[model samples]
Target: MFLKSYTGADDARIYHNEGDCVVRYVKEQCNRHPTNWPVEPGTIVAAYAAHTRQTLYLEQKDFCNKNHPLGLGKPGKQPQRSVILPMLTPNNRVLAIMEFDKDETGFKEEKIHYALAYGSWVTAALIRKGIRESLRDAKEYNATILNCLKCFLHEKLTLNQCISAIMITMREFIRAEKVIFYHIIADKKLDADIYEATSYNRDIFTKVSRKIDLRKDFLMKDVAENHVVVNIHKGDEEQDFKKYNITDPAINSVLCVPIGNPKRLLGIVKVINKVDHPMFFDIDLVNVSNAGMYCTSIIFYTAIGKQLDNTITIANKQKVTLTRHMIPCIHDIIQFRSRPITKPPPYYLSFDWYPTKDELSRDLLADYVWWMFNDLFEGDVFMEKFDVFVLMCKKGYRKTSSYHNFEHAFCATHCMFVIVRTCSQKFSYLEQMALMCAMLCHDIDHPGNTNPFLKASEHPLSKLYKFAFLENHHSNVTRILINHCKIFDHLAPDDYKAMVDDMHRLIVATDLAKHFRKKKYLDDLVKDKRFDDSLPAHKMHLKSIIMTTCDLSGQFKPFDRTREITFSLYIELYKEGDWLKSKGLPVHSTLDRTRYLDIPQDQVNFLSMVVIPCVQLLVQMVPVLKDPYTLSCNNLDIWKRVSFSKLFH
Candidate 1:
């Protein structure tokens, strides 16, 4: 006889002969069913076998006085014994249970093995059926997501129409009772719009309100602040509902997905009451996460479109074009000429390299960059356009900064040239070119201020970028310069796209806030010896580390050069701090001029924490990086000595 273990809405049941007999028990539910069917011996044995994925034998002596469908309870023509075998997939997933009963003749041990052999056939059949169903479901899911994307991209659709289309698609896919979109109206306010897809053809807009305050709602606050998905379901339903402020008894479960990254909160998608399952599963979370990402771009572009319209209005009223135009014929006026490029001096590739005043005055630094690119690319790509591109990047750098100026960019680029040249086999030609280009324009148009200062002072850049203001602005400027110079126009579309993507990623890696996490990831890769140069992900991590190491190359330079660079950075930061003090804002201790005495110790700590570990990892990955690694170690020692001496002074 077949005993199938079935999980019901409120309880679990072991059904004998396809529901000819059933023994019910509560499953993950505290409340008891009104018709409390007594648990039978066969039912218990079958459920146990299914749960443990083990076979069980119950003798007639073990049967209780409870009612049994096989007549064991009354003892007339009853079975003397029963054996329950669990049917399982290859991976041990329970599929069903097979129970056998025998009278006084009893079942021999060999017959039990025969029954087990037959159960495997049933398990295989169930697995095949499951695979077919899963494939069908996956295809449907993909189609729904594609339709949602198409609805979003349709140019003729209104914003309301697009949102409604998305909601309807999500509701049917997830079998949700309702989908409510909580559009973040402002910093502390949200507009809740509810839509119910009772029929696939139509959506009912049951409610719309813009009065919800995020500060007062714990559920939205948690999702927005932490950027987490909140899934609530049965067993803990009462407690979860009370904690998240769900007041309706009808709503038993919820899935709330946040729409943006940690830096920005675009909106939230709340799917209420999953109909097909006890709770939202992993597949549901995956779908909602993807939908949230699409919504982020949609909302961002919609906002940008409005801003662009307003910007045009302002430009029209001022009788001016929106683009920033340089003086006409300025290049001719400056008479900047491109000279024949040659290989850099030996020291230029070493940490001890430092350019003199004559090099800066003669504008020979650009030549060094040109030579590096030409050498790496074998004079194939960017031969003629490179000079123009480098010149444009130079012009983009602001003249007002103490550090993070053109000279700094040049130093960083020179460091990159050394790395790519040493590890030539690890990178392709395009990657080498991208690495050099990223270093060249990484700090273009710098304002000589940190990101936090910009945010605290409410700088214009802060308004334009909610996070990573400096890096994002620098990347944007780099793209503009590249387009203006048309340096990459020679490459095919796919190659050009890859180059641009790599360049942006490399430039963004300069942000030190992300340094520690990236270092740990690289550390793991190195520790496990799992880094394969052929893997794109592994190569990108190495490239990103290279970018950071090159950006901080000054730290491992000769002692005198390192001190000069450090002081220049301190000067720029203190200047910002002085302005902050003037405006009655607090200053970070490192940036505060009053704490200048802590410079040596701070340098020691920075070398210990950031520079040494980074270069050491690079050396482990690429042995040629030992020179810089050794230099960083020496710099840490020097700083330690300096800090000790300061106590006596």
Candidate 2:
């Protein structure tokens, strides 16, 4: 309620809050005058509010007459009524005193109550605004950390380099002058070895003494032992600075956040003197404090190793294969007739030409990816990360499939690359990265069987994922493989999470069960020019659509690749059909091996139904992608001829 704010220790009613923050008096009525909200404590409006603890009303005369000195009165206009409201917090603390300067009349009881009701909503909005602002700040803080990591630590990482990058990143993250990383050596001393970042986001400044010998300083050691973060400014808890004379006074404000987990103190990151303010803010405190956690996670990871396992140990009924599924090491880097991808080659021919069982090159795949994304990941990081990623893709995919192997993955990946290259102008670097990675591992660990075969056979994985069994497994396992090796350790947590999550959705969208639904969704989007590239949701939806066409793209390949894969599909389906008969289950007519001639007819049917419609939809979206549609038409023509020949024979 609008009570008379005390002028002194006494209960004297006065309107003297002109210089306050929460409550104040202003000469002008505008939004910027938070420090000077106008006061009318002695008026009838305030008295009525105090008496009722509700909205108070005053007639034009009562508001503008001698009783209210704060009322604004024009020379010729008639005085209007005033509605004084008490804006309160949930705890009933008066946050602000609100007043409608002019109203039609004070006699309308319903209008007064309506304004009072809106005041309650305003209270909730203010509270929620604080919460939203806090969350926005947190997101921005995290983004800073991620940006630093993405920029600095992408390639050829050494311990010193990682530490230096982190030190500089933490410094820039909080806009501090100097960021020092203290290495806790044998619980004795925190040697300040890592470097610093100056203004303009440069890492040039350094201290003469690279070590903080904690054995000599008791006060500094106490702070180290307690594992506490101390942020000290001139008047703000200056005693926090008094306990430790570790930094220079010219530095002014100092924030020391200890880096470690619950187990042990790994190090302490000390940032002295923020650039903008003489004293650090709460946001600065939060950023540096969080930097400790990120530092610990990195230290823990670095301490362990980045040596990626070339194999996944799969335990089965027979035995535990210590290195069951393995991707062979790159004996040599593929010498691509490496040309710049100014535009996509008609249909991924440069990558998948004259494909053979023994001629597949992991290095070739890695090199093409490195080249394609080199713009985004320049320097050594692109080569380093994609080298590991390519191997991980190979290791994750099963060798059981004649088709759907890493070679097919490579082919499919190149299709996605073509799609991305065609549509690259619209996507962000991260979006491109997510889309590329999604294509690379779309069919990881395939059992060389259809989803129905797996479900009917009651394969463990089918029961596990249940719905999009194989597709979900591919998504989960690929993620596990990348995470296990810590492939994207160079990326910030937020970026890594975004890439991983986006890639997962793309991979899951490859499930044929979700295909028609996703296809229709895109078809609808195209029908109404609803494909807004500016919207993230539309971009992601488009990524899903792109992934679906790319996943089944083996059918749209040129004659040689198409023929080889069609025969391989028969081999896989026949294998499933054989397995189904062995289990005494009635095989579906389409999957029955006895109808071998139907493979071409099925190809024709599939082209006429699933494959052609989706590719046509994609062609509608990206008209430059006419090659795949042409290839689909050509494959349909050949498949029809082959089906007719088989029927006659």
Candidate 3:
């Protein structure tokens, strides 16, 4: 835990570079000790004394009064003495408290005042550390803002998008409820009115495309003509809006920052209503004003059909950083929500729990993941971690992919679920968990390109993870998201690590490179009669085969669904092939869009080659799971009649 102190300016609050050991020690001891001590009151009092230039010295006897009774809530060891000395600034305000707490120790009452000298040194050291951290944070934040600004420096965005981007940047920096950018259309004389405005009011942006009376808006006029920023608060907005005869609800605060070259103003950036803080300061003005300059460049370059320079000079590279909430869960993306697969479907052996075509949404898949996990572990008290894990899975398979998307993940999950049911809960809890998670996160963040294309083109992802091709890279990204989100915080350390390893193994096994090796082993295991479900290694081999089968589950669905899946896969492959060929790289024969093969024949080859063999191995291990194997055979028979010109008919 950390507490911030305002050591630089009145509004500039900064925290020390290191954690407050006092809080950590006190809190940890509170949890570990048998003493039912209240920590909050003492911590607050320490901070208060640190802020108000006071010191507190409490002995065990002092706490033996009616409030504490020998400093024991339920008869536990009590601290002999506690000391909190104010670390004060030169102006006599407390910067912080330097506390020393001891159990079964006597304090030198005469030399206790000597601790006052340590308070000054501690205050100075903490303030210095805070300054260094504040500087580093400011540097990093500036670099990030610069990179975010480059996103707006493009010609592809419509004028409205550009305008919205400008206001968004301003509002984020200033923490304002509203931000408006008004373009100053200049006459030949360079005189202009603040017209063509776009405003982000509260949540959504409303395009206010109208000419405003410049004489009535003196703040904008002052900013445009004098090229100076304006900040007004404390009920000043009421009079300004009244002066313009505008009957809208009045804002509490307003800032007008000029945009464009210093010599000539091209636009005005107006921000209003600081949400997090009470008032807008110089820092907010400076940040919004700097961002407005980039907005000007975007507006000018875009209007002329010329690309604005997006080159960033910062050391930090820009990335699409998403928060835990921003990471799209099933709830975030889906239009409808329903829970159809309420209980285990009838005939868990056949496992024909199919949803209507209209019920296909990311929400259903997310809900299904939760429902299945709940069913598998009936006695589990809560599943907040598992719920977040599913959400992260939905988000990990972003919209960039066509075939390797969340829907594909859901299909794979459905197949795995069916197989699990067929096996009659033969798998352990951890094994089932591994299989389900692996199916959901197998193709996360796929780039629509093949391993061969990635390796040939010298992609950074391939180089970073050289062993397992794209599978390892996918596994890498999945782990990164998982660790960043920290969804499995409830698991024990060893259990968490084991589960992560299992998930990684399952995902990496999806690569075809591991398929034949695992298959050869599985073949030998079956031949030697050494395939024991009780053994972890044998279970892993079974899981590998199951993973392979589930990944190719698209080919085992009904004819319409199989055809749809196959077309989507081919489309993605062709797109990759087009990119590879355009880059003057050799393309795989199957993915070559121009050199087209018989469409259904290609799928027939995939099912006959990959799906049939995988399903054969799976059903051989678990004889009851022959339904999916049969379905794959039926789909292959349907695809045998498909031709390129009239495949659907």
Best of the candidates, TM-score: 1
Expressed as tens digits, the lDDT of each residue in 257-317 for candidate 3 is 7777667667777887776333576767777777666666666766554322342322112
What digit string (tens of lDDT, one per residue) describes model 2 on residues 16-119? 12112223344465543323332334444443243234655556666544544444222244335555676655644344445554433233556556656766
User: Lowest lDDT 10-mer window, candidate 3?
Assistant: 4-13
Please, what is the TM-score per model?
0.52, 0.46, 0.48
lDDT of 3: 0.64
lDDT scores for all predictions?
0.72, 0.63, 0.64
Error of 1 at 36 (Å): 58
Q: Pick the candidate with the highest lDDT.
A: 1
Clashing pairs in 2: 25-36, 25-37, 26-36, 26-37, 26-38
Q: Clash number for every model?
A: 0, 5, 0
Cα lDDT of model 1 by residue, 366-436, tens digit:
67877777777755757776666776677678778878988899888888988888887888888998999
Candidate 2 or 1, higher lDDT: 1
Model 3 alpha-carbon drift over 4 Å, by segment: 1-326, 329-354, 361-363, 378-382, 595-597
Q: How far is 429's C-alpha from truth in model 1 (Å)?
A: 0.3
- TM-score, predicted candidate 2 vs. hidden true structure: 0.46
